[model samples]
Target: MPQGTLPTSLPADNTPKTYSGTKLVTYILAVGATGIVPPTTLTNVAAVAAAANTLTLRAAADTFIPSGSTLTFGTAQVITTADVTATAAGAAVAIQPAATPIAANATATYTNLLEVPVAEESNPTLTDQEETINVHGRITPIRVVNGKDMTATIRTLGGIDDPVVKRLITRGMSISPNNRERIIWLYPDGFALLATVNIGAPTRQAAAGNSQRVQVSANLSGGLFWANLNDPTPIWEAVNGN
Candidate 1:
């Protein structure tokens, strides 16, 4: 009937008794003390050493048992069967299930196009004119050939005052058009088109809320030719392959 001590009946003879079940031991500092130390459980208890007034209990591992403290021994209760089943079920539900990985396929797609900054609304149009030789005696034309009358119309965001637009306009208005080399229009797929173009005067249109737009018309002098943009050699000698 002391503070921090569990209520239990004492034996009539006041002699220590052996317990077969697991033993739980609690320690108290002194008599009538209020603080109750945590209990330690010992399984398969066996007396390793005994003497006239002393007995020692050994554990499987080294454990420090404090001295000068009152000890209380009690039987440790076993866990219920329902508790074990619930713990196993909860562990099984926590594990993630296996999944099948998806295989990827090869795709042919182009993400970028021209290097030059053009308006988003601009859609460049390329046109080709074919030349045919007329035979006076024959009803149908005898020889038909694709002529070098190719032209492209490109639209840009800014008007003639823009640097890029002004450069194109200057090149078109130059006195010596034949001295300039053909410019290359590059594509994302490593292919390029070469054309000695006569850049026409830029036409400008203004609106209230939108930026001024300029339309550039290019006339291919000798026609458009496909070449590799990464080729180190001359454009004429460069060989194109797959």
Candidate 2:
């Protein structure tokens, strides 16, 4: 503890040969030490770990794929949710793809006909509403305007009345009160009925005031009267064996 002497634990050496060149010196011991701590802050957006390591898609079979779209990967690895469903339209069926599913009938659509191109159906098919059947007749007279046969006593002149003529007579197409015949102003383009007047569909004779004005006639329903045949507009063109 004194300034001039070393600690008592050290042994004293008096001889020059014992400690000739080297000297031992002692220094005071300190009680405390200091350290530095680093600063920590969540200041960067890139500090968080990535949400997903990889991007992936699921695959399946027997499913519909969008046109011109590719099924990215082939294996049915993650998912296989291929499904079949109906179309928005009536009675149509379809398959929908789940994820990246493959389709056996890829081009198939919901329809009456097969999706694949094939020959026309040979079996006795039901008659479609769009289908039409044709019948034949001869036009004896082109559309000609005849005067009102108000009291049609005309049929007795020739007992051999045409079938249409017979219907007119039975229907009281001419002489009856509401069904009384009038002069039809025929359309020049013979076959069409731009406007039809009495005998076909009866109209009351124009009132004296309305006489000058042209009148368009809607068809007359045969109430008690028989309906006359439609006027004979001469369709000169006739198909053989029609």
| Candidate number achieving the greatest lDDT relative to the actual structure | 1
The lDDT values for all models are: 0.36, 0.22
lDDT of 1 by residue, 1-242 (tens): 66787659854332322111111111102212222222333222222111112222323333233322222222211111111111111211111111211111111111111123444232223543444455776555333344334566655554453334555556556645632324445455566555556666667777788766666566666545565647776354331211
Candidate 2, residue 129: the lDDT equals 21
Candidate 2 per-residue C-alpha lDDT over 1-242 given as tens digits, one digit per residue, 9 for 90 to 100: 65786676845332211111112110101111111111111111111122321222222222232221112122211111232222222122121233333333222221111110110111111111222334465434333343111211111111112222233333344544444322221122432211112343322233465431111222322211111234354332311111
TM-score of each: 0.37, 0.14
User: Global CA lDDT of candidate 2, please?
Assistant: 0.22
- How close to the true structure is residue 84 of candidate 1, measured as C-alpha lDDT? 11
Provide the lDDT at 51 for model 1. 19
